[model samples]
Target chain A: MSSRYSWGADEHLVVQITEDMSLESNFKAMAMASDLASQQVDGLTDICPANASLLVRFDPDRIAPAEVERIVREAEGRLEGGGPQVLETRIFELPVWYNDPYTNETGARFRDRHQTPDKTDLEFAAQENNLPSVEAFIEAHSGAPWITSMVGFVAGLPFLFQMVPQERQLEVPKYVRPRTDTPKQTIGYGGCFTAIYSVRGAGGYQMFGLTPVPIFDPTQELPDFTDFMFFFRPGDIVKFRRIDEAEYNQIKEQVEAGEYRIRQRPVTFDLAEYEKDPDAYNARLLEVLYGN
Target chain B: MAIEVIEPGLATSIQDEGRPGYYNVGVPPSGALDLYSAAAANALVGNPSSAAVIESAYMGPKLRFTEPAVVAVTGADIPVLVNGQSAPSWTSLDLKAGDELSFEILAGGARIYIAVSGGIDVPLVLGSRSLYALGAFGGFQGRALQAGDVLPVGVGSGRPGLSVPEALRPQFAKEMDVRIVLGLYDYRLTDEGMSALVDRPWQLSPVADRIGFRYAGNPLQWKEREQPFGAGSDPSNITDAGYPVGSIQVPGGIEPIILHRDAVSGGGYAQVGTVISADMDVVAQSAPGTMAMFVPVTLDQALEARAEARARRAEMMAALS
Candidate 1:
């Protein structure tokens, strides 16, 4: 496969593996990024892997632009011919409160910015997908596992793509106008990607629910976030499990008490197998996460 | 060994070379916007190039020194005042205990850097003293300096009379040509749009801040194509991707925004070009309403420019040594 990449000024490089959003494209990007990280090239300051592209930041003084480009191109060539690389990844089960009161109140405050001002974001999204009701939409969303394609837009905010086939994938447009305020942990959906707002700020995504767990902690107070302040990394899979407000409050208490250990299991993600049979692959991933 | 803020002018905060290596998790490398000036000030004050300094935008702070210390001011063309007396910029100066320091009204440029001997002894977050105010995590209390805020200063190894020559300093101008390497998603733009990007004169908008520099220019047009799956209806929106700092993105294909040191690592906007590293300091110095036209350069030219910039910093450090 011919991989396309470009120079981002003298200090950065952007390698685009594909034009559209797909699990294969993301997997390739992750593999390339992971491979680059292992090289430990001097002056390679940061490596950010997105849905279908990889951005590498380097110090021009320490490493020449031409040399860095050569290294990246070489890595891409090896990965292209090396066949599929199975990466050691983790699967996380996140507790979400669908159509929660907090998100509902937030949606009401930003009604003027939504396509359907009279309806909540969950309502509009459910109706847009031809679902019978909000409950049906919630069931569909929670039923399939989603893969974390990228982590950005703030710290630890994961951009998740549903693992189901294209036909079954739910899509929604961003807000007609961006909202100045969005509650932290507000599970938002836009352009076929779901993200939990890591920190409250300006956002355009349509809010559907709220997550009780914290994805980002600057203090690094959480036990799971000991090594890094952020919990989620690219290529990690997450299953958004719907829960009641009571459960949300219970998790909140545990989090406040500093006893909340995020439910996750280490697993290997085989992109080749996942692409062949997504439903079966996802079920196995779920079983690994829940041991059922 | 401290300075007390009598008045925290516009946006004063502690900054260094910025915190790198965190963009993967959406954390931007928040550091001094005009790195050249910041490093020059640090050199003048006998500190390492990465030492933390005070970065003030528009207006400057009024601080009273608690002890005798050496200081240097760089960036912008504004006048620096020491105890009601005007002082020369780009030169090291001695501040007696209880001596007050302030700045005159805005003359030109957007920001100014003040480096004290040793460096601002703020606790480092992620190995940087630079402030990411949006996250409230680093710098002096992770926010802009406030009135009565007392900042601890490192011991002074710098001596007065160490000055940077006028010939070595960057010229602050009302209009300039900022060089960029146009690529990364530039294919999304139309031929006409690509031409307009380099030809048009863009005025820096007043809304420009540390996060990004927004320019008011001719609306760029995009190629007509069926909206790709996962891409939004807007012509400028792409499937969310990583944004290199200094990369230019035209949202709605109208105003082009250049991401800066305090920008989000990635987003959904379609990027067309990245302002070269050397010109980023020039971009930071450009004040609101300044006219800036983008000039396209090859990778070799960008590298040459960066080499020249590194030479200047090395020269400054040698002079101080």
Candidate 2:
């Protein structure tokens, strides 16, 4: 399902090709080429979209592996000269609706790890993090459109890469037991940045927010195999604007009605029963517990 | 034409090849597990490769033919019968409106494919008739077949199927080896771990499906220090790379994951190998408690094997035609 772009420019040129084997290499190659393509096809710089790959957008006609190679070759010679690199990666201050319960408690003993070296009370830094909501964080820190990196190999799951080093510390490992399945609009954290699982399916990434708006529409394609339209590019900037609760509910209702479910039926076991003889039923229970 | 569902035996749904090109948006390419068998079933009945076949796990659904139609049943070796008579597999059959079709427990594979000549008349969701059970897209109401679920036969039969010869129907083995190609993180395993992966016979976990088939009897661990998956991810943890179909991934060092059709678009586990396309059908056929042995092959060998399989399949199709 993953395709590669051969060349990079400020605005991405759609090409098609037969996808061969190595996936990571194809993604890297497209990113490299698209970066170079921002320069003019001839010698003139084009004021095009400042990005490389359409992170998640792939159609029969778009940036496929074969076409990517040709694009790379076509734009290769002229890119060596100085071109106005218009790629100013826009920093977005995400507006966060932080629901963290105790802002005061978090400030009390938070002085352990993150110290500013000014000897200022580390609790003071927690106050800085006290953005009103998730949306507020987006509003303050990010001044410009963000640069996109790779798309999720999974559908609808946007994997935004290369967040500022300061935000790097916010990444954390996923929960011990991942959810069996989540909604399509469920935005998750992969420790790299935020991504929304555009479809309901299995995932191991840590969850952060919920975007009820359906990004991938099955109705639009309407069974015409060739006409399915999926938007978003590898280098495309995705600005997360907070939707109102009313909008969220409307989309949520639609999403809940019908969609694909890709998970095993979860079997529930009482914790008390398992605790009684955890090791006694290891062999027999393994078959039932893991369903393997 | 609609076929009335009398008894939706075991787990059943309609599937075609799959909905490809949606991994970027977190969608798994939901489709048939035993792809060759599914296609073979459709071809025998003069349907295109992309038809919604009835994917019945274990026991097949009981359907009452509503019109004169052509059909075939393949995969998983579930003993099928029409009015209590043994039915042929991988061959076309002409049925009447009064005929009742049913199946029993599969003796060999975990599932069997039922393809009608006209193809299943399912609403195209994202350009596929296949069902994605997670997001609940495609197929009969985007879920498994129910007692009252009636399937539509789309566009009736095409060209008449050639009389199937004796040798054309594929005979799947009760127990077999699944071929694998070393994955991106194959280097992370210890020699012993790799040896166990290929040499030992692992049992297919009951917890198997289109998403993934968990294997028991193997505790494959990384020779290197195991790290939590992610950036600043504990040193030694494998980052979440894309988990392709047939990927043999290890997480928690307890069970090995054999990813399948409905697998997540990505994962953080270490993918040690991938079952080659040539043997992916075999993996789909392995039933719960079935012994599964993994054998390694080089990239060149895998390609050659695939080519050979394609050629053989083509020859069969041509012969039957």
Best by lDDT: 1
**Candidate number with greatest TM-score:** 1
Task: List the candidate 2 regions with Cα displacement exceeding 4 Å.
Answer: A1-97, A100-148, A166-169, A181-184, A200-205, A220-232, A241-292, B158-166, B225-229, B232-236
Model 1, stretches more than 4 Å misplaced? none
Candidate 2's C-alpha lDDT? 0.57
Model 2 Cα lDDT, one tens digit per residue, A1-292: 3333311111122221212212222234343345544532342211111112222222212234344345554553333343432322222222222222222232223323322323222122223457555444444323222334445555444555432323322344443345455445555554544565666655555444565545566555322122443444454444454545565566456546644211122223222343355334222333442364
User: Per-model C-alpha lDDT, please?
Assistant: 0.90, 0.57
TM-score of each: 0.98, 0.70
Q: Each prediction's DockQ?
A: 0.82, 0.13
TM-score of model number 1, chain B: 0.98
Range of the 10 consecutive residues with the lowest summed lDDT in candidate 2 chain A: A43-52
What is the Cα-based lDDT of residue A35 in candidate 2? Answer: 58
- lDDT tens digits by residue: candidate 1, A188-264: 99999999888888899988888889988888888888888788899998999999989999999999999998889
